[model samples]
Target: MTTVHQLSSPWRHDFPALNTKVHDKPLVYLDTAATAQTPLSVIRRMNDFYQHEYANVHRGIHQLSMTATENMEQVRQQVAGYINAPDAQNIVFTKGTTEAINLVAQTFVKNQLKPGDEIIVTEMEHHANLVPWQMMAQAGQLTIKVWPVTPSGELEVSDLKALITDRTKFLAVTHVSNVLGTINPVRDYIQLARQHQIAVLVDGAQAVLHQQTDVQDLDCDFYVFSAHKLYGPTGTGVLYVKPGRYEQMPPWEGGGAMIKKVILPTGTTYNHPPLCFEAGTPNIAGILGLGAAIDYIRNIGIDVIRSHEDNILRYCLEQLQHIGDVEIYGTPKTRAGTIAFNLIPHHAYDVGTFFDHYGVAIRTGHHCAMPLIEKLGQNSVCRASFGMYTDQQDIDCFIAAIHHIKALLD
Candidate 1:
């Protein structure tokens, strides 16, 4: 592992929020797992759209609308390339990862699920992946089976094999555990499900920004992730549907943009796959910002970003372990971008509140992974997640804050 001093991020200056202050102290943001601070390029691109090119996409023949439509469609292609999807037509835009998963649950799985049909989801899934399938199970009289995680926070392939029966129809799992920071073997999971003819949807909200995501390589039926986690604007996400999978899914939402023809009393004809899934006036400015975000990552290179984050995570883990009182969770074989832990004899919320006073921003609580927390025998934990811009200085600040908290609370 590289020393923290030898691993400063060259891209720190690109994110303006690093200079932000709280209680007159420079903000040490370590909460990328929740949402990353937007880079200047993404901000400028969104501002440029609102200032000069505001228009409803795919609705008007006017110049502004045409320009917006063209730019949005280009971004659709960019997203497809980002994940190495089979085709641009396979990408569908949504509010975020939560909606993307829900979109599939409602359209693709809902209609196909029969009573006694089983859906397999891991215990480490964030609520976004778990709740949607639970709702589907309730509505369709399906069974939700849990693929248990080990105490070290890894899913055993044998456990998955046992859970797969002839009745299993779908598998919804996370690419990485947002709480445990464990990078699951999604490829293995997908391959197993493929053999059984079970559809798979990978919740990629925590994986995309930290690693290069190739949907085709993963060979998943559906892959979902949020743009905000990748330094783009919020309220924008991508759902990569396999070529065969999209052809079978009906429109989850119906409106003006998704429909080709609607004869009121007669019938209705829908547009193509991507458009059919995207209803109403989409987030044009946010989509443009997402495009800029993709360009920004490409310019820096995902390999560079992943290496930087790896160093930061390693340094953070070492510091936390050295503290002696800090109880880290999930000693998985491979982890990335995030480290979750609890300061002994101190509540996670209290530690987080003290951290904020020192301008060290982190997330505390269940992290939308209540079941995982319960499985770990912890009610809540503090998470320090890294991004492309995280550097040694931020880690130092966070370490100093931890010492301060221990001194005051211990």
Candidate 2:
């Protein structure tokens, strides 16, 4: 346990935002679950693209347009390689994880479900995963079933097994819980869903930062995540469709590059699977930044980052547990980078604000998982999550702020 205090990240300098001073003190950023601090490499990569190689892609013959198109396509391939996707075509770019899930929900899953068919979602889902299915189920007169979370904030496979029936056509579950810090065994769930011939979509928004993702290994019909959460620019995301699934999904949106050809006053043919889904001019600079972010992760290796963050998470959990008033929410056996808790006599907002005043940043609220919060018998909780650049000093600063706030409030 003493070695945790000596552990420090060598890559802390890569993120320029960590050097920022909040209220005359160095920033102690513990809110990576909300959005990670962008590294200089991603910023520089986007700036260079906008300054030198700026142009629209896939619609022009000019040199700049060709260069931008090549770069964007290369990033698509890079994303594919990063996730061990079978082909680049399986990767579809979207505005973010929310849009990606909606795309699958509205088109692919919706197409398959009948009026009485059911879609299963877990209580731990973010609104992105839950709301879309709810909307679709309402519109189509389909039933929505929930897989319950245990008292310890972990999911039980037996609960899911009991929920499955012939009517279960689709399942949406998170690879990791953003609020509870639960690393769900989604691959096993996927296998179970496969046995019942149900399609599964794994939301990887929180998992990608701390775990090495392999789409083929998970074998989900669809996987979605945002680039921003993975240390890239905002407004960019990836949705990977399994082989042969895209051919079944009709385009969710239509315009611009998503068409093969438009015949006015007649029927129009659509482009291939991914291009058909991407619609309109994409986020060119953001996609390039996403490529740079993946490159950055590759250079340092995901295993190394995971080991570093696991230590930080273990230490942070230990420190929080040492404080009697602190009530940690989830005690999942396997978790990665986040912990949610609240001080017994203090509201989460008060504690978070106090932390902010002392140059510490932590997320406080439902974390867009209101149903899970309600299940935990709380309206909201404070969350502290780690990143690849998080180190022992940051954890020390955060712990000290917690003690300071406790002393004052007590």
Candidate 3:
């Protein structure tokens, strides 16, 4: 195991938000699971695009429009390469992970699965993954099967056989738990799901930012993640559809860009794969920023980033455990940098409120995973999530802040 300082990111200087002072205290942001702070590389790319190359993509015939469309489409290839997808044409841009999940549920899953068919999701899903399926199931009268989570916060893999049947139409599971930080055995799940002919969509929002994901290697049917969490701009995300599934799927929404031809009397034809789903004009500057962020992460190497996060997580786990009142949750076999815990005699919100006094930002409450948090028999918990910019000093300061908060409250 390496020391936290030894794993310190050389790229922290790329993020300007880390330099901000709140109430004269330097910011120690630890809520990256929600959204990551943007690197200047991403910011500059967006700024440059807006200043010089701004245009509505795939619609205009002029020079500015063509250049903007090329830049945006290049990011599609970049995303495909980032995830090692089978084809760049399979990558669909959405507002974020939520919209991506909705795309699958409405267009892909809805068209295929019928009433009384079953779909499996974990107890650990963020609402983005869970709610859309719940809505779809409610509408289609489909049965939603839950993959039970072990008390230790891992998915109950042994229960998979029992949950999946021939009637099981789809399985949408999170690659990593936002609250428990569990790096779930998703590959094994995918392998198992394949035998039963279940289409799997992996919610990669929390996992993609921390580690590299090769969709082709995993062989998942669909993979969705938000680019913002990868230190890119918000309002932009990716949906990577497996090669064969594109032919099976149809246009999700109707708009100008997704159309091939429109005849008044007879019919209308739709554009092919990627553009079929991207109905309207997209966030061009944000897409450029997303590309820049991917470049930033690639320059540093994901393996290096993972190693650094592992160091930080180990250090954080140790320091937080040393505090007596701390109740750390989820003893996972493998995990991410996001850690959840509760301070006895103090609610999570109160702890988070006090932590901010020390300029340490953390998330509190259910974190949009109400089902999982409620399953744990707690309404709220304090969550400290990490990113590439996080370091040893941040954890040290967080630990000190917790002690001070406990002492002050007591």
Question: Candidate 1's error at 146, in angstroms?
Answer: 0.2
Candidate 2, superposed: residue stretches over 4 Å from native: 2-6
Between candidates 1 and 3, which one is better according to lDDT?
Answer: 1
lDDT of 2 by residue, 1-410 (tens): 83854468888999999999999999999999999999999999999998999999999999999999999999999999999999999999999999999999879977888899999999999999999999999999999999999998988999999999999999999999999889999999999999999999999999998989999999999999999999999999999999989877999898999999899877899998789998999999999999999999999999988988988888888777787799888789999799999998799999999999999999998999999999999997999999988888898899999899999998
Cα shift from native, residue 20, model 2 (Å) = 0.9
RMSD of each: 0.9, 1.0, 1.1
Q: Give one digit per residue, the lDDT tens place, for model 1 in 214-249.
A: 998999999999999989999999999998887668
Q: Give the Cα-based TM-score of candidate 3 against the true structure.
A: 0.98
Model 3 spans > 4 angstroms off: 1-4
TM-score of 2: 0.99
Give the Cα error of residue 142 in candidate 1, in Å: 0.2
Q: Is candidate 2 or candidate 3 better by lDDT?
A: 2
What's each prediction's TM-score?
0.99, 0.99, 0.98
| Candidate 3: count of backbone clashes, pairs at least 3 residues apart or interchain | 0
